[model samples]
Target: MKGIDQAMNTLPCQGCKGLCCGPVPITGKEFKKIQKKVKTFPRKIRERLERQPRFFGTCIFYDIEQDQCGIHDVRPEICRAFGYHKELVCFRKPELATKEKISFKESPVGYLSIDFTWKDF
Candidate 1:
C-alpha cells in the first residue's frame, strides 16, 4: 500500500464533511460485495456501481447531516484508501482550502485520475 493509503487507514478524519466521499470509484468485485451486503441499495448507488470501475458522485451511503459515511465498514477499496497526505480540503466549499493546494504526484488508481480543482467544484 502507498504511504497515503496507510496514513488514511490510521489517521482520524476530524471535522470532515465527506468531501472525499464524492465521486468514489470501485471495482466490479467490490461493487458486487457491497450489493450483497446492503438489503436495499439506493438508486444512485446502484447506478454508480452498475458499471465497473466508474466514477460516481456523492456516495449514497454518506450521511450529509452527520458528515460521515453511513456504511464505513463496507465502504469500497477506493474509499478506504482515500486520505489527505497533508492538510484536509473542504471540497464542498473550495474557498475553505484556498491557501492549501492539494496535488497528486500520480493517479490513486492506475487508470483513474482525481480531478481536484478548486475552481471547478
Candidate 2:
C-alpha cells in the first residue's frame, strides 16, 4: 500500500495521455476564443498550426517520451490555470511546491477539515 507521497509522486499524467495540454480539438470558434484570450490573434497563431482546423497538429507541448512538457517555459496561460488557488479541491490534491503546506478537498463542500478518524493508532 502506498501513502499519499508515493501515490502522488508516481502520478501518470506525464506518461499517460496529456489531455490537459492538447489543443483539445476545439471548434473553430472555441479555438478563436482561446487564441484571443491567450494572445497572438488570428494570423500569427494560425501560422503555428499544421492546418487551419487543427490546433498546431495532434500534439501537446508535453514530451510524452520524456514524461514532461517540451516547451513548459512557454506553456500557455490556460495550462497554468488548470488547478485552484488558496483552496484545496480534494484530499489528494497535489502539493504546491510554492505555497506553505496548505492542502484541501471537496468532501464537506465549501470548506472542511481532514478526517483523521480513518487512521489506526
Candidate 3:
C-alpha cells in the first residue's frame, strides 16, 4: 500500500479541484476514522466545511477553498485506490491507472455524502 500511496502522490491532483472526488463508499472502520478526524477539526473549520456548497454529488469532505480532500490522511480505501486501479482510473491521467481493479476487503457501511453528512462527525 505504501507503493500505491507513493504512486498516487505523483498524480497531478493539485489543480484538479477534486474533480474525481464524488460520493465514495466507506467501511465502518473508515467511517470511524473519518469521524474521529473530523471531530478534531476546530469548530470554525468544521462549520465552514459543513456549510460549503458542493456540486451535486460531490464529496462532503472535499474542501473547496483548499481544492483538496479535507480528511485525506484518513480517507477511505476507495479514495486511496482512485486513479491507481483499473476500474477507478483518473480521467486526467488514465495512463497512471494499473491493470488490476480494486477489491474491497470490507463491505461499505454507507456512502460519504449520502449516508453520512457533517453532522455525523
Choose the strongest candidate by lDDT: 3
Regions of candidate 1 where Cα sits further than 4 Å from its true position: 1-12, 40-56, 84-121
Taking every candidate in turn, the Cα RMSD to the unseen true structure, in Å, is 11.0, 16.0, 3.4
> For candidate 2, lDDT tens digit of each residue in 1-121?
5697676544345444444444422233433343344344354433333122212332433444455554345443333434333332222345433333333221221100021100110
lDDT value, residue 51 of candidate 1: 38
lDDT of 2: 0.35
What do the candidate models score in CA lDDT, each in turn?
Answer: 0.49, 0.35, 0.86
For model 1, residues 1-121, the per-residue Cα lDDT tens digits are 6987656445344566554666765555555555565546576654444332323455555655555665677776656545432344434343333334345433432111243211111
Estimated TM-score per prediction? 0.45, 0.31, 0.89
Q: Which residue pairs does candidate 1 place in steric collision?
A: none
Angstrom error at residue 92, model 2: 8.5
Instruction: Supply candidate 3's per-residue lDDT for 42.
Output: 96
Candidate 1 at residue 40, lDDT?
67
- Candidate numbers sorted by TM-score from highest down: 3, 1, 2
> Stretches of candidate 2 above 4 Å error?
1-12, 24-58, 85-121
Candidate 3 versus the native: TM-score?
0.89
Query: Which one wins on TM-score?
Result: 3
7 in model 2: Cα distance from truth in Å?
12
